[model samples]
Target: MKLSKKSMTVLSFTLGACLFVSTAFADTLLGSGYDRLKDSAKNTATLMEKDLKNYTVEALYSLKDNDQTLLQASTFAKMDTVNQLSEENTVTKTAKGETTSSYSYSDKKLSVRKSGMDNTYYVTEYPADVNRKGPAEFSNPFKENGAAEIEKIVDAVVGSLKDYVQVEEGTDGGKVYSGSLSEAQVPAVVNAVSSFGIKQMLHDERDLPKIESDIFVKKVVGTAVENKAGYLENVTGDITLSGKDKNGVQHDLSLNVIVKLSEVGNTKIAMPDLTSAKVEKVSYSGGFSSKYVGTYKNDIIMDKDGKFEKIGERTVVITSVEGDKVTGKYSETVYPGFESEYPNKDAFNFEYNPATSSTFTYTDAKGEQKNGTIHPNSAGKVYFEMNIEVIDKNSWKSSSLKPYYDGEFRRIFE
Candidate 1:
C-alpha cells in the first residue's frame, strides 16, 4: 500500500519512540543484540500469529486550560490469527457518544459500522489495499529482521547515554528505566531511524513534510517497567513540540501517553452478521426520475408579480407515494438576503387531486386553519405551495408565504 509522507513520518516517529522505550528497558536490564529476551519476544510474535489477542486501550485528550477533556475514547480489539480476522469496537465520547465497530479479514477486506446514541447507523466497506495491520510495536525492535534501523539509532545514542537513570525496581523484581533527551538530540534521533531509508525499504515514494523549519521536539522523557519475560509491561512518556501557529504566535504542545497490553494468545473473538444490517446510500444530486424514489434538492424560489425569485436551497426526501398521494419530509435554509428567520426541516403528507389542488390543512401561530397546495409538474418534477391558512397538525407549513417547498425540485436519487 502506498503511504503518504506524513503517514511515513508518523510511523517512523512512533517506531522510534517505541523502540527507544522497549530497547532502553531490555538493553539496560538484559543487554542488547537479542541476547537476553530474544526467545521471549520471538515466542510472543509467533503466538500472535498463531492464536488470538485481545487488547483494551483508553485515550483521553484534554486542553491545557483547566484540564477540560476535549475527547475521550476507549477501544476493545480482538485479533484471531488462526482465522485471519480482527475486530475493533471503539466508543468515542465527546459532546455525545459514538461507537464504531470494524471487522477485518486477512485477505484485505474490511466491514465497518458506526452507530451513535443520537444518530442512525452508517456503514462502509474498505478493500484490502486500503487496510493495514495495527499496533505496530509488538515485535522485537533490535532483531535483525525487525526495526534494525531503530536499533542502529539506539546504538548511536549509547555514547550519549549520560542521561539514562534508574527510575525504580518493581515489586515483580524487574528494573524500570528512564531517560531524557535534549532538543539538540531530536534531529540526530530522527536521522538515526532513517525515515527516508525506511520508506525506500518499503517501496514508498511519498514526500516527507518539512519538519526542521517549523516543528521540532522540545524535550522527551520516558519511564518503562518490564515484565518477567523481559518485555515492557507499561511505558509512560511525554513529548513536547515547539512551533508557531498560522498567526505567527509561539505555541508549544505536549503529549502524554500510556500504553499497556493484555490477553495475549487467548482472546474471545466473534464476528457480527453484516447481512442483517441496513445500508444507507448518500451521493450528490443526480437526475433521477420515478425510478429514483429518494431525495432531491433545489433553490427555494418565490413568485412576485409574475416573476420568480430565488431565496434558498431546499432538500426533500420522498419516502413513498400512492395513487396521487405523496408523503415525505423536507429541510431548507434561507438565503442571507431573506429577513430574520429560522431554518427548519419538517414532514408532510399530501394527496394530489390534480383537478382541484390537494387541499391540506395547516396550522398557523394562532392555531388558525390554512390551506396548502401541491402541484405536480411533468414526469420528473413537482412543486408544493403549502397552504398557510390551514390549522391542521398533520399539514406542513413554512414560515413565509412561499410555504412548504418554495420552488420546483427534480428527483436526484438513482
Candidate 2:
C-alpha cells in the first residue's frame, strides 16, 4: 500500500526571535564560512526594509505528491509605499482540480478587489490600518522576514555543505551559488533546513496536511543569484519530504518555491479601470457584535470648567439589542460641592452610525441630543469610549458641573 500524497504530514519548528534586539539587527546571522552569501542576503533584507517605498515582487510556490499536483499558488504585487497604492494578482489551484484567482488594486481613495472568472470588482475605501514595513505587509517590504529566514536556513545548510557549495560568476557580473543535499543529516545545522519547508507552510497560515507517519527530509536543492550591487535578485529551491502514511504506505511530498525581486523603486501602482467591471461602492462598518451587550459603568469627577470639583457616576445598563441598535437605560448623577446627588435617569435607545470605527446616536434625559463611540481595548476584553459626543452645551450641576466624554468601560455581553 502506498501512502496518499494528499495525506502527508507537516512538521514545523522555527526559531525564536531575539526579543527587542534592536529592530535593525534583529535577524542578523553571526556565523562564518558563508559570509559573502550571508551578508549579501542579510543586507538585502535590511536595506529593502529600511526605505522600501516602491517595489514589485513575484512569488510562486507549489506542493506535489509523486507526480500529482496537490497545491499551487502564485502572486505578483506592485506597490507604492507613500500613497499605500498597490495592485496584486494571485492564482491558486488545489488538489481536487479547483482553481481560483483574484486581482486587487488599492489607490489613495478606493480599494477594488476582483475575483471569480467574471472578475467582479468589490470596491471600498482604504482601510484604517496598513503595515508598509514588515514582511507581513506583503507590499512595500514584501515578506522580508521570509527572505531573511530563508537566507538563514540557506546559511546553515551551506555551512553543513562546506566544500559541496558551488560558486560561480553570474551573468550580471554578480555571484551564483548552487548546492544540494543528498540525504537528511542528523547534524543540527543540516536539520535547520527544516525551516525552509516549514516557512512555506506557516506562511500566511496555509492549510496543513495530516499524515500518521513521521516524515523526513529527503533532499534540498537551491540556487541563488546575487547582483553586482550585492542584492539577491532571485532565489529558487525545492524541498522533498518522504514518509509513510497510517497504512504503512510510502509517500513523497515536494514543496517548491521561487522568489524574484524586480522593478525595485521603479514600479508604480495606479487606480484601476473600474469602468468596464462591476464596481460596487462599499462602506465597511462594525455593528453591535456580541461584545457590546453588557452593563458599563464609569466614574466622572470634573466640573463645567474641566475642574475636579465634583464627584459623579455614569452607569449604562444595556438590556437588549436588535439589528444595529441597542436599548438601554443610563444614570448620570453628580455630587457637586459635596452637596447632594443629582441623578438624571433615562431609558436610552442608540442606533449605530457609520463613522471611522464605531458610532452611536442617542438622546439624553433632558431631551438633549448626543453622539459618541466606543473603542475595544486589550484584545476586545475592555472598552475605552468617547460615549459622549456633540452634546448640548449644558452644565452637570444646576449651577455648574460637567460630564466628560472618553470613559473607560469594561466587559461585554452575549
How far off is residue 256 in model 1, in Å?
2.7
- Evaluate model 1: give its lDDT: 0.44
Stretches of candidate 1 off by over 4 Å are 1-47, 51-74, 91-112, 115-146, 157-169, 173-175, 180-216, 245-248, 273-414
lDDT of 1 by residue, 1-414 (tens): 122333334544543453353333223543342223333344445544443244333333221212333234455555555444556555554423433333232212333334443232333333333323332223322332325675455446443342233345567875565566556655554444433433332222211112222544566676656565555545566655554433455444444566555665555555455466654432111111234356767775554343556767777676655433455655566778564332443344433332223245445344555565544333456665543433232222332343323345786855
lDDT of 2 by residue, 192-222 (tens): 4453434343321223333335555666666
Residue 163, model 2: lDDT of 33
For each candidate, how many residue pairs have backbone atoms clashing (under 3 Å)?
Answer: 13, 1
In order, candidate lDDTs are: 0.44, 0.52
Query: Which 10-residue window of candidate 1 scores lowest in summed lDDT?
Result: 281-290
